[model samples]
Target chain A: MLELKEGVRHPVDFILNGKPARGLAEPRMLLSDFLRQELGCAEIHVGCEHGVCGACTVLIDGIPARSCLTLAVQTAGRTVETVRSLAAEDGALSDLQEAFRRHHALQCGYCTPGILMSAEQFLRERADPSEQEVREMLSGHICRCTGYVGIVEAILETARSRAGAR
Target chain B: MKPKPFTYLRPADINEALQALARIGEDARILAGGQSLLPMMNFRLAQARALIDISRLAPLAYIRKTAGEIEIGAATTQAQLLAWPQLGDATPLLSAALPHVGHFQTRSRGTVCGSIAHSDPASELPLCLATLEGKVVLRSSKGERVLPAAEFQTGMLATARRPDEVVVAVRFPERKQGAGYAFMEMAQRHGDFAICAVAAVVSGKTTRLGVGGVADKPTVREWSGLPNGELDDALNDFAWELGGTDDHHATAAYRRELVRRLGRRAIEEAAKCSS
Candidate 1:
């Protein structure tokens, strides 16, 4: 049997929210734990350590991923984005964030960050996304409050608004 | 729950990974996407004394097609395969079923072979593999061998692979020309495991029907000749014969009923698409 040795810590250096960050994590440390406990970024919540709950979703190299399932060291040299990155440099809310607020898409707010992250990426990848597409994208995320009516509306409105801007 | 402490080794290539597996033996588990293993570990359902991190094996990340088949490397992510422009044309069944495996997020990190290797009875990829008659390539220090997807997966979370061997790639031989495809699943929620899922590839004279979540492993039953009355009754009766057990998510009887309903719907859906 392979032995578990002591004193193993891998160095992880990466770009987070457009800022450089570094940390040392055991091989088993989850990225969600690294973000919340080590970096003190609490916005990314962990509802189920399993992949079923999308609460721990984040952007790895700009792709939406469940941070709870990813190892901390796996983010090495990659760009990581969280709900915190959705705001503008001047502190203005991004279009999607503003849309969420306008539509009251969130209640309890635990699932909001992950939803916002997933929605933002969904919009970024596809231009002029249909309402059905938006709903399909949100299927990965669960919202206890609002029953996803406002959340889906907000994303659809954001897509329309973004299309007008373009 | 945190996984029991285990040493981690990131091998740069497949040879190194095989060597590490041989050295570590049963104590080590291959860390691919970790979409399944991490959850199992966190829930204390799976424990490993060590992990061979093969995510860095760049050579194993590829999607190539020959004249008659599509080959996907072990390190290929589910999302990557989904996004490939040619995938829908080459393997319509896979393209149709990939989105149902999990959410887009989990799919982003989940590897092709990893999903195939996990062999979850309710998993979409395995059902597609079985329906399409795919092949799984496994390699270890003892050398490499190829097994049909039907032979590769033995049972729920069980496979024919020896502990030392790792599934290296999956090959989907080309489907019959002008085959129609449909994938349908009845999950509690979107992205949830299907209570019962079905995939069908229908040509003018032959139809391959695959069912999941009604048994310990996905089952593929093929029929020759166009859809007939006997097919529906036979399928419903056949579904009852699957090794289903009552669990919290569903009852064995409920699963059988789902198999009957979803199976008919899937066949209809496939029949509609046959060009």
Candidate 2:
């Protein structure tokens, strides 16, 4: 059993994006803060701090979850993927990101990273999804800008293009 | 806002988790999905001197079906239940209501037992449990005991579970032959909390109705046989018995009316399925 005392910083090791990352986190520290502050992962945006907002959404072991609702200590030895993982190796945007750009899927870009992370996993799990299914998945996120029309189009177009490529 | 400082304990197994709970007692809280507990901690609404995280306990993550009941381990996530192939056939009410519990993201990490432990009046899982008359299995260092859903959930945000006991699993009765089930809820947003939720189980002449988000806790009432007018009157009386109160989300009268309307719809649909 691992016991970390309160009011003290403990080392938490995890796989960030794909590389190994370690951060010092107090027992009370949330995974969202630990990723952004301790590990210098600025891509994780903090919105409501509670689980309601999707701004802090990330993939823990390839499953999308709310980082704000997760404790930093809980991610020990687990793989945590942020929006940064969606980009290509040479700084080129992935197909989904490219689709978002073409469809004007984002307005303020605050909720884009979380939405992209969620969409990446959603598409991976379901290669061919109906518009209703896509909307249901997107319901986890709250996008105040773009009215969600562009975001939906971007995801559907990405699914269609990806299917065509396959 | 961050949680208050507290010790973090990751138990190796269920036994270790139970022992720690026995040692820490009321000062400790079991962290199983963290979908609800974390939010309360972040908002400073709840404080724990220690958090025993059972999420990593591989032994506690399972869904077992034996005889006519489905037993969900403490660590089993809601997503796992939804993805189970037998979900639709084993317990159709859970299938219809699980999607409305939370969004895809939250469900991926939220545990069924954790939601029950939280005992939120607006939550769908407890409502389903009440409607199904499920059992909550609690274990401690001393021994184990099981309580019915109605007995386990004392009131909103409260349960009858002792401080030293850990909810190991929950058992829900499987689908009965020739029975039909339906769940319906009214929430402002898709993933938001329900303003009023209803679960109906229609089998033969007996009809069970469980209502949530209208009272302090989910309440279930059964009617054996009643004419259409009598059933409406009975539902109206049940609604009044619940004493629905005005909240920021809805008015008392609006919620009572929903009970009369949605209750009828759910019962009718379930009856259709059974027929």
Candidate 3:
């Protein structure tokens, strides 16, 4: 919705999904908009647009953040990971994503991408997280569908599986 | 869903940022995290001709404990502070209150001084600062001034900061050992703006209580071990003195009750902290 205007733009170069991606982004353009429109990363869903919804969340420099609230230029020299980065090289699901599928963690799926990114980061930080701990980490994410029951189960299962593998 | 067009300037240094801010004056807004500012801009609630981006100004991203206070640089992200174990020991109230600020995503980019400067009545950071008698450092091309948190936040979404001055950092007066503290809030959801919240520090028999969302600015007061039993009478006399009015989140009458109940609970919990 912002490209129609002639305004100041900045050339952004960053690592997106293990690949170099460069684009000219306006100052007023949000990272969510840049990822969706310019980089063609459509997994970032923008709900409520006000940052309340976790639909547009992404990993900036390996930390989950609301891309809708981050400007495109802010990622000028950083690494960004979208939900698309969760798949294996052969397109098989990551352990976390498989758990999500096995547990039926999503319903409408609009909030799935953001939740997956958030859970992935949480799991990375905490190799063995309790069910309560998982809930607390996920409290920041809002999952309207599934009542957060299946999502919680999925992350817990993944954490258990990872610990068991060790 | 889009912000109005504006020019963006990423100053390489703090002095350069200060100079540009002084030159642009009210026309420019400092971009720190953009959690609140961007959302406001998207809703057309705020507009600026220019935005001075300071999120990456390395000099302003620091947390230092000096003398008896913790100095937090303006660009210090909430996530960074939350990860600091030393801060957890020094300012337990801050660590306890941080998780309630926003979800993990917002906290990842939200800045401490940004939250202080935002000065939302229901925000947990402001409530913690007010309860701790913290100070905010305001800097400009001319000079710098330090203001106590109580004096810095003038009203809802308003502060004592001049247009040319940027909130360089915030200073939290370090608490002594055995000062038990707790933060409690009633939000509609986990990450939503709190309808009413309270921060309390219980040191022996005395207590310091700060209530948010019930006033234009958070209300802080040092009290004796007993509760403020005169709340009903006090409301009649100082309704305007409090921070909140009748808003959509909660009615004034209901908020007053929360202040009474939550304030008591916070003090009780703080007393249980053991240190």
Best by lDDT: 2
Which residue runs does candidate 3 get wrong by more than 4 Å? A1-6, B225-243
Tens digit per residue, CA lDDT, model 1, A22-63: 988887888999999889999989988887769989999999
Output the chain A TM-score of model 2.
0.98
Per-residue C-alpha lDDT of model 2 across residues A1-166, encoded as one tens digit per residue: 8899999999999999899988999999999999999988899999999888698899999999999999999999999999989888899999999999999999899999999999999999999999998888889898888888999999999999999999
Please give, for residues B1-275, the per-residue lDDT of candidate 3 as tens digits.
88888888888888988998999899899989888998999998999988888998898999999999999998899989999879778898998888888877888899999888988888999988888999999999999999998789999899999999999999998876888989999998776899888898988767777888887788887756554565444433433456356777788877777776777788779989855
Candidates in descending lDDT order: 2, 1, 3
Tens digits of per-residue lDDT for model 2, B230-249: 88998999999999999889
* Candidate 3 residue-wise lDDT, A1-166, digit = tens: 0121228567889999989999988888989999999988888899877788778888999999888888887788899999899998889999888888888898789899999999999988999888877877777677777888899999989988898998
- What TM-score should be assigned to candidate 2? 0.99
What is the TM-score of candidate 3?
0.94
DockQ-superior candidate, 2 or 3: 2
Models ranked on TM-score: 2, 1, 3
DockQ, each predicted model: 0.54, 0.90, 0.47
Lowest lDDT sum, 10 consecutive residues, model 3 chain A, at A1-10
Q: What is the TM-score of chain B alone in each candidate?
A: 0.96, 0.99, 0.93
